[model samples]
Target: MASIDLAIAGLAIGAIAALSGIGLLVTYRTNGVLNLAQGGIATLIAYVYREMAVVWGLPVWLSAVLALAVLSPGIGVLLERLVFRPLARRRASAAESLVASLGVMVLTLGMCAGIWGLGAQTDTPAVFPNKSVGIGGHHVGVDTISTLIVILVACVSLGLLQSRTKFGRQMRAVVDDRQLAELSSVPADRVAAAGWAFGTTLAGFTGILLAPRVSLSPYSLSLVVLETFAVVVAARLVSLPAAVFAGLAIGILQSELTQFTVNGSLADIYRTLGSNLFVVVLLVLLLAIPNLRELGDAGSAGSFSSRGGQEDTGTVAERSKDLVWRVAGFVMLLAPMLFAPSDLRHAFMVPALALIFLSIVIVTGYSGQVSLGVAGYAGLGALFSLKLASGGMVGIPHLPGLLAILVGAILVAPIGLVTGYPAIRRRGLTLALVTFAVGAVVSRFVFEQPSLAGNLTVNPLYIGGWELGDKSFYVIELLGLGLGMLAVRNLHRGRLGRALLAVRDNTGGAAAVGVDVRNLKLLAFTMSSVVAGLGGALLAYSASSFSSDTFQPIQSLLWFTAVVVFGADSAVGAIVGAAFIVAIDVMAPSGSSTLAVGILALALGWLPGGLASAVRGVIRYVAEQLADQFVAPASPIRGISALAPAALPAGPGAVAPSSVGTKPAVASARASGSTAGVAAADRVAADRGLALTPFGRTLLGLVGGGGTARPTPAPARANGAGPGAAGDIDRHATVGAGDFGSRNHVEGGHR
Candidate 1:
């Protein structure tokens, strides 16, 4: 009976999760775009509702209706028109759409943080009264009953709409293939817009209902809603009924778990597990499920690559220019060493962060693998390094900071192999969710474990019993960065680079061609994880402290976004992105850097290849224009004087005097470089049995020599002849034969 009551108590959360899962499933099914920003939209709507009801003194029903009905759906329509429509029109890849949705998520969170100041608000108003009633020995809250009723009605209505309505059929058509649907006379755009509007309304409802159950904050509610993604994942993003059922089952199961009270150290673990059951379920489902059949095209991760202009071998001038830019970049990277101690301390994060960003570049850019769990690897690195240095880890002796960092990175490499093995089969959003789940699991279980990470310490790098000061350490970091860059350069060149590129461009094709796709992917993952581990260790040592929060799952998303925004494939861009992020955060208020990155990412559709590629394009265009200005145009053929008539072959094709010497007076009057002179020279050359170049033939035709027919001599001009009439007749027949031969030759050559 108590368990039944607990399940009833859990029904409110279950209903909210149902709404969230349904919203996600609907958006994905209708628009063929998984709405990662659903949580963001929910958070935004929840905040607006709270402000309207509590701060602005609006009626509860009015606030709920205005926020859910007006603001939520309006935002959806606006996003469809502005962000998604452009991507759809361009036929952007699914990975691109995924990134855009992430941008939206970050932007919304940033906005909420900026407006609400990151503080928790507990004064959220509930739409349904918090009154309860007894039902057969179990007490149930009115709000809980109302939520269940609402979810049932919503689900039934949606099922009927999808099964019975023409608009729903049109939506299904659009989802199957937007272009085909349009060709079949269905309004795909309108259908997509309607889908988004309805989906976002459900998101709004989820947020409004859940906000009163928990503290209203920018991150808390959003994260809570994000955890509900488990429901959607379990449903495979297809079945609405499955999603609803999963939500309720998980919610009730979580509540039931709370009833158990274990003894000893396991108690805390058990409690944490019960509390975070959704996260655990998400992780387990991602790993346990062999495959998820997504709707529409299951796009590859290659869309993240830069779509720059045509590839060209660098000219000496371009090479020199690139060298100058590289030098300037190095100068910028090293300049921080000369700054004040405080500023230098802040700058220390640059190399470490850049290294971390470069790991993302290696995996996502070079291998086309979508890894969202880099933060997990980094956290593991930090934890392992700390444990090794303090002699807390089993079978490992206390070591100096440098050795610990190295060993920690080396040890983490195998973990990458373990994680990357899953990626051999998974791709796109499935792979993305799997990686994110790994990061979340690590954050919750490993990083948050008091026994493991609570007493961790990070010591600065040391060599030969001599401690390196901040400046010296910074120099070492620069050296480490240089080594990382060198390794990346090696990866980007030669045979190995080509192989990786082949796999990235087309995995199945690479496999068909006998390339070991599995091994190459694992190798990329291993190397990237090592790089991330090294960076994590350096990050810990730079601050001379360790905190799990430093390597949170959200930080992974930011790092990925920053790398992409600055040019995912560009090492220099990674360095610049790190500096840019650090500078923005330092110069502006908190969360400003996130806002900046979010804005740039949102504009990724318009600015393909990101900031670095855009800059390169502009520079290349300018340089080409300048080069064109200095190039001279071709000179025209001068005159027949350049083609001696005496050089004509003395054969059956001997020069005819009538044709060669009767150059029209009008032709001589024209300038040497004129079109007429060029044509006359070509005709004279051809008459002398010389082969005509294509350009010369074209010139002769343009000036009416080869293409135009000559007027026939008057038949027997009154006395059966004029002066040089026989020569004129012979010349005309010879010239006609030469023109025919030349035209045939040109035509044959072209073919």
Candidate 2:
């Protein structure tokens, strides 16, 4: 009876989860974009409903209708038209779309925080009454029953629409290939807009229904909705029924497990697991699921990398320009040391954050793997360093602060192997989801645990009998960064660099050419983790404390985006991104840096290779222009006369020009015994943009006395006109001239 009652009590949350899952699935199926912003949208709508009903004293029904119907769908339509439509038209990579969705998420969360403040709201309006009814030997709240009924109605309606409607088939076509569907005269944009609108409406409903059950807050409510992603993942992002079933099952299972109490050291662990069952399910499913059948092409991970500025060899002028840029960058980095002591301390994060960003460059930039859990590795490093320094961790000796950092980073390297093993099989979104789940799990279980990390202490770094001050510590950080840069440079050069590039460009092709793709991926992960761990340790030492919030899962997303926006493959870009973030935060409001990054990320379609690549292109162009100014131009060649040959040079190295309309000199060489010479002459002619006509070739052969070859007649044009008639035609021919004209002629004639 107790279990039955608990299950009944769980139905409200189960219904909300179902709604979220269905929303996610529908958006993905229709738009072919995994909407990471769904949770943010839900949180925003919930906040709006709370403001209208609870704060402004509006009617509950009116507030619900306004928030769920008008506001939610309006936001959806606006996003489809303004944010995602351009990306779709450009055929952007999956990674780009994912980043854009993340931008939307960040922007929405920032809006909610900026407007409503970060304070929690306890009183939220409920659409259904709190009354209860007795049924089947149990008392269930009216809200629970209402939620279940509403979900059922929504699901049934959605199922029928998807299965039996013309719009649904049109949506399917658009999802499969937007260009093809548009060519086939389908309204792809409208179908996509409708899908987003419907999906966001569901999100609003879920948020409103669930708000009354939990304290309404920007981050907490949004995180709760994010957990519902487990339901969609369990359904393979395809089937709505499967999503509904998974949501209900997990909710019921979670409620039922709360009935049992365990008294032991592992009791807290069990309770936490029971509470966060969805996270556990997510991690397991992502690890166990071998393949996901995504709509459209499964995009390559390497597409996220920049395309320009990868040249290994350059001229002296280019190399000198690079040197000047490096010097200027170093000057900028070191200038912070001249600030006030307090301000200098703030600048400590620059190098540490740059090192963390460089770790992303190692995995995503060099090796083409998407890792969304770098914060997990970083948080673990900080925890380990603190524990080791304080003598709290078992089986590890207490050590001085500097030594602890080294040992902690070395210990954390193996965790990258754990993440890398999954990356061996997964890629793109699946890999991203898996890494995010890992970070979320680590953050919840390890960092948030009072027994594990609550009392941990982080000490200032010291070197044998020397207590390091702020300036000394900053210098040490710079040294560590130099070492990381050295390692990256080595990785980007020689045979190893080429192999990693080959793997990144094309995995199957790399393997076909004998590259060990698996081992290389593992190595990249391990090295990246080491650098991230070192950076995390430095971060803790710089602040002289350990705070779990410093390495939250959301921070990882920001770091990844910042690295990509600056230039994923550019080390200098990573450093500049860190400086920019730190500088922006210091100069602006709390959430302003997030807003700035989000705006830039949303505009990534316009900047294909990121800020670093764009700068490099400008510099290279300038260098070429400057170099060209120093070189003298060549004298123009004298034209040959029609009736007479050109004068020959005085030396054997010079050759006489054939008369106009004669065969090219190279043709005479080919007719003679010097075919290789003809090949060489052809190369020189190509460099000079010289075209060899058949008549010219025959005349050259006769002039050189190599042969008396007859001239070959030109083929008739596609309009059945002779070569002479084709020649008489205007340069801008109509479509009737067919092959005699360019593509514009055909298009113009059709018009």
- Per-candidate TM vs. native? 0.82, 0.82
lDDT of 2: 0.74
- Model 2 residue 235 distance off true place after TM-score fit, in angstroms: 0.8
Question: Mind giving the per-residue lDDT tens digits that candidate 2 earns over 378-413?
Answer: 888888888899988798879988788878888888
Clashing pairs in 2: 662-696, 663-696, 663-697, 663-699, 663-700, 664-696
Taking every candidate in turn, the Cα RMSD to the unseen true structure, in Å, is 14.6, 11.4
Please report, as a residue range, the 10-residue window in candidate 2 with the lowest summed lDDT: 699-708
Task: Tell me the TM-score of model 2.
Answer: 0.82
Question: Residue-wise lDDT of candidate 1 within 1-751, one digit each (tens)?
Answer: 4889879867777878988899888888888888988878999999999999999999999999999889999989988888998988877778888888888888888788777867889989999888899889778898888877877887898899889999889989988888888999999889889888988999999999988889888767877888898999999888889998999999899888878899987776787798788888998998888668777667656666663311111234434434533665687698997899999988988898888998998998888888888998988888888889988889878888778888988889999989998888888888988888888788888888897689887666678989898898898888878877887878866457756765765576556545688998999899999889888888888878888878877778778888888877778888888889888878888778878898898888898768766766677678778878996753333322212323322344433322332344323422245687656654454443332211111111111122222122223121234433322222221122233323332110110
- Cα displacement (Å) at residue 414, model 2: 0.6
lDDT of 1 at 279: 82
Ten-residue stretch with the least lDDT total in model 1: 694-703
Taking all chains together, the TM-score of candidate 1 against the true structure is: 0.82
